[model samples]
Every structure is written in C-alpha cells, then in structure tokens.
Target: MKYIPLRESKKEELEAWLNKSNEILAEMKLETNPKKRRAIIHRNKSHWRNDDLLNYLKKLSDGKCWYTEARFVAEYPQLEHFRPKSCARDEDWKKCHDGYWWLAFDIENYRVSKPMPNVKKGTYFPLREPAMAVCDPDVAITRESPLFLDPVNQGDAELISFNALGQPEPCPEPAVDLCEWDKRRIEFSIKRYGLDNTELCDRRKELWVAIESMISEYATNAKRATHNDCKISKGKAEQLIIQLKKYLEPSQEFTSLISACFLSNKVGKALYPKLLTQLLAA
Candidate 1:
C-alpha cells in the first residue's frame, strides 16, 4: 500500500460526529457502570457513519480500501477504527476491553478498509507492550503503538516489498536486517491484510510480468531501431504505451506492486530514454 496522507482539514466537516463522540467519552470519566458506558460508546461513536466523513474518505482514497488497497465493490466501504473501539486483541485474540474509548470519536483514528480485512482486524489492536491507559488521549495513543503497520505512515508502507511472483514480503533486502520486533510487526501486517491472498498474488504477478516483459521489449526494439535494424511494430509500440499509462498512472489498481516494479533500477534502466522521459514528465 502507498502512503495515505490524512486530511485533518476534512475532519471539520465531521464536527457534529466528533462532538457527539467526545460527549460520550467525557461522561465515561465519572460513570462507573460498564453497561452504560458501552451503550454510550456504541450510540455516540456511531456518528462515524456519517456521509460527511465516509464520502470524504472515499474521495481521498480514490475509492480504494485504505488497508487492502482493494476497489470497494460492496454497497459502501467499511468505516474502520485503526484501534478497536470496544476492545483490543493480540494474535491470540486476547481481548483488552479497554479499547481506545477516548479516541473512538476522533476522526484521526478512522480508516476506510474493506469488509474482509476490516472484520479480520476487528478490535485487534495488538501492541508490543501492555500499555496502561492514561488520562490524556494524545499521550495514551502514543503509548499504545500498534504492531500492525499503518498504511498512512510512509515508513510503514515502505516495510512491504514484493517478489516477481507478486507475493508480499515484510521487507526489501535493506529491511531484512531490521530488529526482530520491527520485522515481526511487518509480518503481522502482511498476514492481517492477506497480502499473500492468491487472487492478490495473481494480480501482482500479472503486473510484474507485464511490466517487465514490456520494458524488455521496448529496450530491445528501441536499440534495434537506433541500429538501423528491424524494430517493434508501430501497433505493438502503441499497445506498450497504453500499458505504461495503465500501470504507471496515479491511483491505478494494485499500484503499490506496479510502483515496486517501476522503482527497480534494472527496470528503469531498460526503459528507452524517450519512454522514460514521457513517464517522468507526466
């Protein structure tokens, strides 16, 4: 997944929802009744379902799930909390009932994820430490850092790498040397997102093979044309151009894989200067 820049400015449109959530949380400060708290949390936090936030996020994501990077084919995308609203869990499903209740209403915690991964990640905000809750929402959030890498974080997004088969791996060669904890975190994210799902794998594989093959053909043809030898057919060259645009343009499907291919030095070197120039200029 590519880095998703969160737009705090857009959250203003969701002011009413945020206010409701904040009010519920504020009441939880003194209320000792768990049942009451849950109802309040559920009732108030449901403000997240508003069209203001949902439509805005849909537009921001370019209609892709923030987690799986899948096109949202269902009636609507699922509104996911980065941290569980009711409770948190580890890989073993050990629940920490004290979900980020305070931040449940906070727009910063919301992400547009697909139904599958969203349900899979349900209330499971695994962390390396058993973080104790603090009074301050800001400080508490920082204390409970999740093991699942967030796509919003550029560094977290970079942790994902791929092979020619298009299967996702935790790291590139450089990241292989990371500390055990960080490595485990990346692995968890991959599994959590089903990055290795056969269908996604097939998509990645197709992108990898298509891009690589086209680059090789372009390189060979361009070289031949320069040497006054037989070159690629004009129709074939036009097809290659279309493929390049399809794969390289912004917000393309499974673009992270396509990006991984483009960033490869070997692939870039194979692109003729003319083609490379056009791509770069775009």
Candidate 2:
C-alpha cells in the first residue's frame, strides 16, 4: 500500500466538521436531563451522517480500504469505529449509552473502512497489554490488541514483504517478535478479508506472467540476432532492453524482478544501463 497524503482543503473540511461535531457533543455533556442529552445526540448524528466525509476519506486513500487495501466503493464503504464503544467493563446503562454516542461523533475515532477485513467474523484478536503499550497513548485504545502496521508510519513496511506468489511473508529483519506479529497480522488480514480466496491474487499473478513473457520475448529476439551474426550489435541489444524495460516500467510487480535480475546476471548487468535510462524516461 502507498502512503496517502491528505490534501490541504480536505484537511480543512475535516477539521470544520470535527469542530461542529465537538460543539454538539459538549452541549450533550452540559444537559443534565437524560431526555435532552438523547435529543442532542440524535440531532448531532444527522449532521455527522453527511456522505461528504466518507467521500473525502476515500479520495485521500485512493479508494483503498484503510487496513486491507481492498477497493472501497459507495455502496459498501463501512464506517468503522476506531475506538469501539462496546467496552466489556462498562456497567452503567446511561454511561454506556453516552460513551457510544460520544465516540460515534468523534472524527479522530472514525475511519472509512471496507466490510471484509474489518467486519470478518472471528478475526477480532484482542490486543495484548505489551502490544498495546507500543501504541501511541492517544490512539492505543482504538487498536484492538495484537498490533498491526500503523498507516501513518513508513517503518511499518519493513516488517512485511509480498512474495512473488502474492502471499505476505516476514522480511529478514532480525526482530523475531515483531516479524511474528507481522506474519500473524498478514495471515489474519488475508483470512479476515478473504483476500487469499478471492481472484485478486490470480489477477496479479497473470499480470506478472505477462511481464515475464515480454521480457523473455525481448531476450530471445536479442539472442537470435547474436547467433545469426556471431556478435551482438550494441544498438540492437540496447533497443531490445529498452523495449523490455518499457514493459517493466508501468508495473510494480515486474520492476522488482528486473532490478534483481540486473544485479545478479551478467547479461542483465550488461544491458541494464540502457534499460534504466528508458525506465526513467517512461
């Protein structure tokens, strides 16, 4: 998943919505009468119901789910409560109701998520205290026990890597505990979202196969020229490499393979400079 940057105008709009929502929540807190507080919450919920907020979030995330990278569309974008209102410890009816109502309106506690990974049954692993301690205090409660990668932090990507088969694996990072957690989270996310079961992996594999085919074809064409003349023309080899690199340039799947091949093989190393130039041009 790529890092998402919130646009300036979008940030301003979200802040404005938060300001309005907090005002209503503050009013609810002041109203000692139970009926009045209920009425205030009801009225405030309507204002928060505006779809613009969801749309803005979707745009910020490039239509991907916050956790799973699943595509989120208008009909299925689920409103996720980062801080779940249903804490097991709460006993008082009024206090429980208030907690639920108050959190629902808090912008910082909300995220536009897709249903699969977020709503999947039996995937709600409670966070262990040690894992929870790693979280920033302000947002720790929202991250239900076993920690997952923080979307805001680039370092999180170091823990996991996608294999050629499209399955996630722990990177060789030496921190075994963190790696184990990363693997568990990846597996949990896959099963919870049914990502492994879906056609997404198949589609990515197909794309990769196509890229490999193009590279193979270009290499074969160069080889045939070399055999015919007993020597490979520099210009012709450069042209073939350029074409192969073009295929790799537009695809993330192929780029990594191309780089690895260039670093490890003599033929690829010889041709890589031209390929790199072409790739950068594209």
| Top lDDT hit | 1
Q: After superposition, how far is residue 120 of candidate 2 from its true place, in Å?
A: 1.1
Query: What local lDDT score does residue 36 receive in model 2, on the 0 to 100 scale?
Result: 72
**The CA-based lDDT of model 2 is what?**
0.52
State each model's CA lDDT, in order.
0.72, 0.52
lDDT of 2 by residue, 1-282 (tens): 333343223467677777887788778667777667667766666665577787777775667665545455455687665444333111111222123445657655555666664565222333444333222223435445443443433455344444445444454333555645566665554554454644555654564555455556566767777777535554565666656666445333323333444433455555667767766875
lDDT tens digits by residue: candidate 1, 1-282: 767778434467667766776776688766767677678777665477887778888777778888767777755788888877677777888875467666667677888888777877777777777655433455746665678988777778877878789988756655447778888987888888777778888988987888888877755665566676554554466566667766665567677777667667474444534455677787
Worst 10 residues of 1 by lDDT: 267-276
lDDT score at residue 281, model 2, on the 0-100 scale: 72
Clashes of 1: 0
What's model 1's lDDT at 20?
73
Against the true structure, what is each candidate's TM-score?
0.84, 0.58
Number of the top candidate by TM-score? 1
TM-score of 2: 0.58
